[model samples]
Target chain A: MHVTSSVRPPLITGGKTYADVTEDICRQVEGKPTKEWKIAFTISVIVLAYGTACLFWTWWEGLGVWGLNKTVGWAWDITNFVWWVGIGHAGTLISAILLLFRQKWRTSINRAAEAMTIFAVLCAASFILMHMGRPWLAYWALPLPNAFGSLWVNFNSPLVWDVFAISTYFSVSLVFWYIGLIPDLATIRDRAQNKVSRYIYGTLAMGWNGSAKTWARYEYISLILAGLSTPLVLSVHTIVSMDFATSVIPGWHTTIFPPYFVAGAIFSGFAMVQNLMLITRVVYRLEDYITLEHIESMNKVITLTGSIVGVAYLTEFFIAWYSGVEYESYAFINRATGPYWWAYWTMMTCNVISPQLFWSRSIRRSVTWTFFISVIVNIGMWFERFVIIVTSLHRDYLPSSWAMFSPTMYDIGDYIFSFGFFFTLFLLFSKYLPVINMAEVKSVIRSSSEKLPAKVAGVAKGERVANPTFNKDAE
Target chain B: MADLHGKYLVGVYDDDEVILHAISKIRKAGVKISEVYSPFAIHGMDEALGHSRTRIGIAAFMFGVTGCICALCLTIWTMGIDWPMIVGGKDPISIPNYIPVTFELTVLFTAFGMVGTFLVTNNLGPGVNPNMFDPRSTDNKFVMAIELGKNKLTEEQISQVLKDSGAEEVNIKQF
Candidate 1:
């Protein structure tokens, strides 16, 4: 039986029945796109068009259009890559980790979050391709055998590990998200009035009849996927961090990179989720499904992960001095007081100091504050990666070779391209798909809904047996 | 496409808990249930229908094992046995360095394998028309279908049993 604590606020308000859940979630998919959606879509497409042109010219001109010097080979490309990849982590965390934890609130937001993961990874992968001077030779990164050579991709290289990690993560996340969508798609299919809509949704639904045996197997497979994904998500960022950590650079070669990067990933990821979801909740009028409780719960996660990232930053600094290596110590000192100190301090203020505001219950629950800070956290996270990659390389060993890096229009445009691509995909998904997991939410209605009478609510306080069939009128 | 051909008695209920209780009652009355469909998965309905636990987890484990083995073989065969080359000043057969790729491939194989097995076993795939008892079953209704050929009870008797066991509506469905 479904059981939830009485002290906790109702996960679903408005006393939604199974039919209401279906109606509320499916309305967006079945109905016409709103004016706001049209406007947003137009803007995103325009940005995507301009950015694509810049990206095409960058590739056509052979990476010379961007500001990459001999001293600093990596710049906004790798930074944006890590930043977008980190943003993708929140989706898996909400879907897989929260599923394992049995968080019922995740039912409302997990679909959109997981979609975000897929699109964010696509944006991140775009950066990888853009960074590769010859995008056609990108397959060389894979471990495919060549007809002319005995050299396989180096298994010892973290870059090779990244190829495997990212591809696996993308495919697995896509499968998991699609599997979860089948039942909901069937719901929409069954309700569709138009023949074409019915046929399209019917195909996507895959003939899901909701048989008891199939449901049993479906639940089991979902659990197994979640189990596999937890470690997979952690491993992805760990491997990504190892790309730098395994290097011999004084600031990059640190033992703490794995945990540090993972925490930072979840931190930035939650902030991105907050930003997208807050807008989605308002634009779609999904305040009932994505309630204030969900917002507060996600804010708490942002706080916890943000704190871990803060500690990691300080720990890196202390260790730099504690290691007594002059190069390592100088790297940390230069990061705080170097020419790129604005970026470093911006990272500190946005990521470390900003999320601390969530400690106040009001601020955590306030939509305005949450949205504002989420934007700040995203900016800070981008700078965090920029600081690590650029500062470490900009002033490496020899003074004669040291140089400051600046981004040309191409670098800025490529970064904007990701934003354009991500928003374009997300807007389409929200417009055409059920943003909430209807079946999962319906299952919890008996236990977590606010339709219980006063007496039943009192009885259910601090105890089980909340009476599953309490609200006959609700059905 | 004509996987199901049957004349059946369909019982519709609104609440999951009520249908769950009705399943045991109807079965106790000696009527065999062909299937029960609902918008959401009803807990304990499988046990109430006397279905044993599914073995998809076992398949998942086996797939995971296969993935692990394949990853290990790929790394070892390519890095060590095929062409031994020293990269990053490490051994060609370094297992520690192989851990990340090995772990990733294991998860990838397990996820794809398990989902493939699940879809295949459920007879679910794109463009497959579902054998539906009631359209509302996907909306708000819990539909219990009893194949007339499998059940020993008369249609009238089965309808009465369904009505008495809390089915809001009972009807005959032919496919």
Candidate 2:
């Protein structure tokens, strides 16, 4: 409602009506796939198949199939885990955080972002499963009664906390996404051309009829869910950061890691969202719904959070020098000047230096530049996690144990496998589900319904005596 | 048609404002309204129709409190009473470390509980058939229905009331 003239660009560009909103969104679901979609889907499947084979090979031969040595035991595995987890943050931030703030623009993008969250979390969970050499025994991580001398899972460890956080995060996000989808699914259900499609949409819709009573309850539930997910978006990452913060490792023990990791997570998350939205907008030909203004607003968030992450980077360096602990100072120095200095410099440039370009209004608004920088920012964030995990562990207190960590073919293969998995799921989602939320987008339109002043005039002059301005029904 | 419940006169409106205006007009004439439908949520239509504010938030709060209590009890029972093991030189009954999982379960239960309450209250589930007043009610049109059996008004009076209230089309629907 607070409309700044310049910042308040019309979210839907083409003056779409309620019917147009439904048609544009439901078309992708009901219609045949384009040539572009076929090509992308094929490539994604191929990559996915190759990645799955690599993962099985690692599992078949043991963790040694990857180049992981004793010193860098968590090199690419945890880096991919954190990277995927960070990418998932953008979805909840958009759906839950922005919803509470009443940013109406989020309606256009939240659906796809929520789907991305589910897939990214799936990818993140896979890394944990793969890292456990005998994944069948991964149930030991849960707080279940084990046969090993009644040894219960440790309640004080961050790893155990992660199990609860990630699982709850997944189920809650899934429910929230499904609840939001109901009404839109009803719209699709009503418009389905065939019996099979109709039944499928009907089951998904769960008997939504758009009754006033149901809408009232639905709106209330949505607000409360958004309220619930806000703290969740923050807590999941804070627990993840605790994976390092609670440790005794020199580079990982800083108090700044919680908020710092959170900021970096959001920065990278938005970058990934931008990357996906750029491709989605093009492939789906949804420029009108996903306007340039949406891109610019997301860029503005990146500029702010990116700057916060940049400051956190500098703050870590200052604290390292200020504390003057030999091990801690050496850890920071080793990150910048040691064998893995390239990874550190990569993080600095991508996470800090590159995103600052958004300070220019022109670059932030340009689709190509935003896309390019988003990719770079994610790369930089991946290296940040890599630098923190590998460099710190590769060199410890004993100089005799000093070593360098490098990823093997299997390591590289597994990461690409995630991309394949992510895109394949995403492509399927885009084809089946309503990409844009029809109900929410309709709420944002200026016209609530069709203007029929001429029809209202047909009710006779006597009816107007009761309500004089009945003809001003343009809204 | 054999399983139809009753005869209801349905009035269609192009705009939400018109429907709001029509509801008051029809109800003021001593006609009982059965239901109203719209494509999207109108801002104050529920209040105008005299429905009470939903108590879902209260349910969410109570569920959240339950989650908090359960989480604390689970952590205590598992770590302190069941089997105590020192971790990272910290106490087995450390409450600070218990906060993360506790907070997570609190949110998780609250969210699931609230959604469950909503679904049950609405009589909705996977295979249940919905009552549809009109297909276009989920699209662009708004509809208000007055069941003849619920009100003592004659067919002529109800039709007249709908027209006087500026209904675009009035139809006799059996569902």
Model 2 per-residue lDDT tens digits across residues B26-113: 8888898888988887777776788889998899999999999999988888897888778777888999989998999999999999
Q: Which stretches of candidate 2 lie over 4 Å from their true place?
A: A1-7, A148-150, A447-475, B1-5
Model 2, residue A250: distance off in Å is: 0.9
Q: Is the docking of candidate 1 incorrect, acceptable, medium or high quality?
A: medium
Residue lDDT tens for model 1, A1-475: 5555667688888877778888989999999999999999999999999899989999999898999999999999999999999999999999999999999899998999999999999999999999998999888887788663446989999999999999999999999999999999999999999999999999999999999999999888888899899999999999999999999998999999999999999999999999999999898788988999999999999999999999999999999999999999999999999999999999999999999999999999999999999999999999999999999999969999999999999999999899899999999999988988898888777777786644454223222343445323222
In the range A360-473, model 2's lDDT, one tens digit per residue, is: 999999999999999999999999999999998999678888778777899999998999999999999999998888888877664211221333332212122225464343
* Best prediction by TM-score: 1
In the order shown, the candidates' DockQ scores are 0.62, 0.60
Interface RMSD over true interface Cα atoms for each candidate = 3.5, 3.3
Report lDDT (CA) for all predictions: 0.91, 0.85
RMSD of each: 3.3, 4.0
**Candidate 2 collision pairs:** none
C-alpha lDDT (0 to 100) for residue A37 of candidate 1: 94
Reference-based lDDT, residue A396, model 2:
65
TM-score of chain A of each: 0.96, 0.93
